[model samples]
Target: MHESPITGNGDVVKARQAVRVLAQEARLSLVDQTKLVTAASELARNTLSYGGGGTMRASIVTRGTSTGVKVVFSDQGPGIPDLDLALTDGWSSGRGMGLGLSGARRLADEFTLDSAPGKGTTVSVLKWAR
Candidate 1:
């Protein structure tokens, strides 16, 4: 597993690049790699902009003969109060168009989100190799 702090734009780019490398190492297809990278970028940005900086953990996962990448973004900032509204399309709590969370969810094979009013947020996404 590889971990990086998401405190700035540069860190976000590094996180995206790290995930790209992991995706390549996992032998993910070109399409899958792009999808994972895009999702990671969006999530990383959210971590910095909304979460007030956090950490990104990327790991290679396996299940029998299948291989995949799992990335978790965690933060200790103010958490999401309305998960349903946050997941909804075209909603924005800040300056964003509000598609970051929802779009990331659509790109990954599996997605999980945990958050509360004050406990912060944790989002995990996994994309399996084809």
Candidate 2:
């Protein structure tokens, strides 16, 4: 499967379009498409809000025994000083309920976060076909 990279405003319509393209090409079910796209939205928002602008790298890959759609978000923001606290629901820095990453984690089948105080942040989420 091929991959597409998106950046900038992380517009809702564009993000969903990217997801639809993958799901269509991969022959993923409608249910999976909805969840995956929702997860994408969360990732995109974080990029826009905290990172002051970030990049969204998406691809379909086969890893080991699992094949799925993966979206990676990276940003050069102030960096999350408190990952633990940041992930908490309703615990936001300023204009968030603090549920972005946490919600994304719950929706995705596989989630990983890499962040530091000043070095920036990277997040990856994969949703495998069921």
Candidate 3:
């Protein structure tokens, strides 16, 4: 497993790079790597811009005959009050394009989101190698 912090823009880039490296190590196709990296970048940015600061954990996993990379972004900032709205494609609490969560979900093979009004938020995504 690879773990890193998401405190600034540089950390977001690092997180994206780490996801790319893990995706490559897992033998994912170029397209799959790009998808995962893009998702990771958005989530990492959210962790910094919205979550105030957080951490990213990424790892390569194997199941049966399939291999994939999983990444988790966690933050202890003001959580989403409405998950449905947050997941909407054109909804943005800030000045973003409002496509981060929804776009990441569409790009990832598996997506999980957890957040609350006062608690923190955590987003996890998995992309399998073809």
Quote the lDDT for 44 in model 2.
78
Report the lDDT tens digits of candidate 3 across residue range 2-58: 999999878988898889889999999999999999999989988888999999999
Mind giving the per-residue lDDT tens digits that candidate 1 earns over 1-130?
9999999889988998999999999999999999999999989999998899999999999999999999999999899999999999998787678988999999999999999988999999999999
Q: Give the runs in model 2 whose Cα sits over 4 Å from its true position.
A: 1-10
- Candidate 3 off by > 4 Å: none
Candidate 2 lDDT, tens digit per residue, 42-72? 7777877787766677788776876678888
Ranking by TM-score: 1, 3, 2
Worst 10 residues of 1 by lDDT: 91-100
TM-score of each: 0.98, 0.86, 0.98
Give the whole-model CA lDDT for all candidates, comma-separated: 0.95, 0.77, 0.94
lDDT of 3 at 64: 95
Clashing pairs in 2: none
lDDT of 3 at 111: 99
